[model samples]
Target chain A: GGIITQTPKFLIGQEGQKLTLKCQQNFNHDTMYWYRQDSGKGLRLIYYSITENDLQKGDLSEGYDASREKKSSFSLTVTSAQKNEMAVFLCASSRTGQDTQYFGPGTRLLVL
Target chain B: QQQVRQSPQSLTVWEGETAILNCSYEDSTFNYFPWYQQFPGEGPALLISIRSVSDKKEDGRFTIFFNKREKKLSLHITDSQPGDSATYFCAASLSNYNVLYFGSGTKLTVEP
Candidate 1:
C-alpha cells in the first residue's frame, strides 16, 4: 500500500501572484500527473511526467508549469493567478502510463 | 470539445434502492474506462473500471455495464446507502495514451 501527500491543503493567492503546489508519493510509481478541477467541471490534465525530469503538457497547460526533480516528487506552479479564481489542484501517480492512478487529498486554491 | 459526457447532473435515491449513472464518450479509440467517486473536500478515488474487451464488470454491489457498439457505459449501485452519496465521474483513455478524459460528473444523494 502507498499514500500520496499534498502540501498546503489550502492556498490563498493574490491576483497576478505566483503559487506552487507540491506532491509526494511513496508508491514508487513511474508516471505522475497534475490536474485542475473547477467547480461543477471535470478534472483537466495540466501536465504529466513519465519519469524524473521528464514533462509533457496536457489540454490545460497554458498557464501552468510542472517539474519532476525526483522520481517520488512532482510540483506545479501557477505563473499568474487569475482574479477571483478558485479551483482544486490534484496530484496523481500510476505504476505505468496506462495503469490506475492514485491521487492525493488535493490542494484547494482561492485567488483574490 | 468535451470528449466524455455524463447524464443527469444530480440524482437522488432512497436507501436500499439502485442508483444508475450513465456516461458516453466521443472517441472510439478509448479502450479503458474508469469510474471515480469523490466526497466533498477530497480528491476523487477510483471506484471501478472496465476495458473495452469486456462488456460487464462487477465488484461487490457496484456493477459497470458497457456497450461498445453504442460508445456508452453505465454504473449501477445496489443497496445504496447514505454513505454512498458523492459525486461520480466517468473517465476514458486510450490504451497507448495514458491521459484520461473525464466526464463532468453526476452528484448522487442517497436518502435514508
Candidate 2:
C-alpha cells in the first residue's frame, strides 16, 4: 500500500509571510486536492488538480494558491499569513470522479 | 447560506450506546454524499458514502441513511466506543465534479 506524505507536520509562520506546503502521493492517482480544516468547521476545498499542471479554485480559494507540478505531487501556498490563523491543511487523492478519497496525515499551520 | 449542515455540533454518549450524526444539504444537485472521520491532528478519511439512488448503505458497524427527496443523510455508529471519539464531516457533491462541500462537523465523544 502507498501513502500520501505531507511535509512539515507542524508549521509556524509570521504574519504576512509566504508559506508553502508540499504533498507527495505514491498511489499515482490522477486527481489531487488541497483542503483547509478549521476547528469545528469541516474540510473546505482550497484548490484541486485533476492532473499535472492543472489547477482549479474551490469555494475557499481566496488567499491560497495550489499547483500540480507533477502527477504525483501537489503543493499549496498561503499568499499572506494572518496572525492567529490556524488550520489543518489536508491533501487527498482519488482514483476517479466521485470515488473514495485517500488522505494524507495533514499539516497543521499556525500563523504568529 | 451554509451549503451543508450537520446537527448536534458535539455529542457525548456512553460506551455501547448508539451515536447518530445528522446532515442536511441545501444543494439539490448533490448526487453523492460521503461521511469522513477525522481524529485530532489528522486528516479526514472517507468512512462511508452513498449515492442518491440508494436509500441506505451499511458497512460493518457504520451505516449511512440517505434520503434523496429530503436532501438529507445521516451516519449511525452502533455500539459506540471511546475510540470512536473524533470529528465527523458530511460532504456533498455532484458526480461529475470532484469538489465536495462539507458541513461544519460533529464532534463525538464516547465515554466509558
**What is the lDDT of every predicted structure here?**
0.95, 0.91
Residue range A1-112, candidate 1, lDDT tens digits: 9999999899999999999999999999999999999977989999999999999999999999899999999999999999999999999999874558888999999999
Cα error of candidate 2 at position B89, Å? 0.8
Tell me the docking grade of candidate 1. Answer: medium
Candidate 2, residues A1-108, lDDT tens digits: the string is: 789999989999999999999999999899999998888778888999998999989889999988899999999999999999999999999876546788999999
Best model number under DockQ: 2
Taking the true A–B contacts (Cα pairs closer than 8 Å), what share appears in each candidate? 0.71, 0.78
Interface CA RMSD, all predictions: 1.6, 1.6
True contacts kept of 2: 0.78
Assess the local accuracy of residue B60 in candidate 1 as a C-alpha lDDT between 0 and 100.
96
lDDT at position B75, candidate 1: 99
For the second chain, the TM-scores of the candidates in order are 0.98, 0.97
